[model samples]
Target: MDGAVIGLIGTVVGAVSGVLGTLITIRLGGAEQRRTQNDQSERQGRSSAYSALVTACSRTYRVGYAAHATLQAEGHQQSPNDAETLEEFRSAVEEALEAVSVVKLHGPNGIACAADNLASAMSGWRSEVELLADGRGDDQRASEAIELYEELEDRFIALGRETLSGVPARP
Candidate 1:
């Protein structure tokens, strides 16, 4: 073959190879971008879910205290020492724990575990609240319950601070 013809063939092959390589690189880059976008979307979803959990926990706490206050004013005359009232208050604490437990910012963030512990603690305190609510006015027992709840509340506050960096913990 003529030298010019051979040179022309070589140039065409090099040009075709470059075009193919560019197309392959573009495709790969597009695929990578899609994966990153998906990952970001997933993180956003998890974040949203975590926020809702905190809200639920706050709701539980608010409702429990509200109920206690309302019942006290109404003078329903149910012995605070009664099992039902104790159970209800304990449940409210549990709900608060549930919300705080949404702190899944890390593995075994222990929100659920802490909440379970708080519920157990509330059960112990319930007896005193029961007396107080019943209008029996067991000062010591109520004081003990308050002290215990304060500790649990502190734990929740710490967790809230750690898990929700940008958001403030609910009052």
Candidate 2:
């Protein structure tokens, strides 16, 4: 009977279509899932990098502040300041600058600007330290160092404020 044959053919076609449709839908869903996962991974990587940069900058800033405090506390304004003390302070500044450089935090324009300012400040501070360690200490050098360190402090403060606004704080 044609009716029976037609029914059989329709069922076979319907079953085949259902199977093909399911395979296509599964493939599409898999592709979508992969895209979603990739997006999440990229976001997490960005977040980690951002957090690391901020942490490195903050830690280096704190070190610079400590060095500044030590310099001031150790007969800062007096003539004939201790060579050892100045050298130690210089070392701290150098170490902090190295720390900042290793982070490679310059990016996203605004962050880059802050990083540049901070780098300039660090360079100035390190130069003064080198001068002092080289027995080239002078009142002028000390005054200049103070100015440079102040700029460094300002940059870090600004960075911290901006980063805090963007990055979540610790729980």
Candidate 3:
């Protein structure tokens, strides 16, 4: 073979290899960017869900505490017109449930479970309060409900913190 022909073949081979390498690098970089964007979007979604759940839980707790305090002050007396207060409590519970639904959709399984447990505890406490007002429940039961609700709330908060901490800080 001629020396010039051999050189021409070598140059063509080098150029093809360079082009393939560039194409592969670009494809891989695009994939990496997509993965990064997906991670960021997921983190943001979880963070927003966590915030919403926490806020709803806090509001529910406040309303429950107020109702419980009022009952305590009344010494569990039978009031003929407690409908308004009951309705307010129910509204707060509904809000919490809605927020927890969001958490279940956006958060990890563990966090979702924790939020569910907390909501259940809150509901139990509410029922216990109703029973107390009707003079059908004992102080012991109400106290137990309160303790369970508090413990679940603490667990939920801890789970939220763990979930948030695992998320990387945004630039």
Top model number, lDDT: 3
List the candidate 2 regions with Cα displacement exceeding 4 Å: 72-74, 77-125, 132-171
Q: Is candidate 2 or candidate 3 better by lDDT?
A: 3
Candidate 2, residue 86: Cα displacement in angstroms equals 8.4
Per-residue CA lDDT of candidate 1, range 1-171, in tens? Answer: 999999999999999999999999999999999999997775565455556554554554455454445445544666434556556666766665455445444323455455555555555555555556667755565566656765875675555455446455565
Assess every candidate by TM-score: 0.50, 0.55, 0.88
After superposition, candidate 3 runs with Cα above 4 Å error: 74-81, 167-171
Worst 10 residues of 2 by lDDT: 99-108
RMSD of each: 5.9, 5.9, 3.8
TM-score of 1: 0.50
Query: How well does candidate 1 score on lDDT at residue 15?
Result: 100
What C-alpha lDDT, on a 0 to 100 scale, does residue 132 get in candidate 2?
Answer: 49
lDDT computed for candidate 1: 0.59
**TM-score of structure candidate 3:** 0.88
- Mark the 10 consecutive residues where model 1 has the least summed lDDT: 100-109
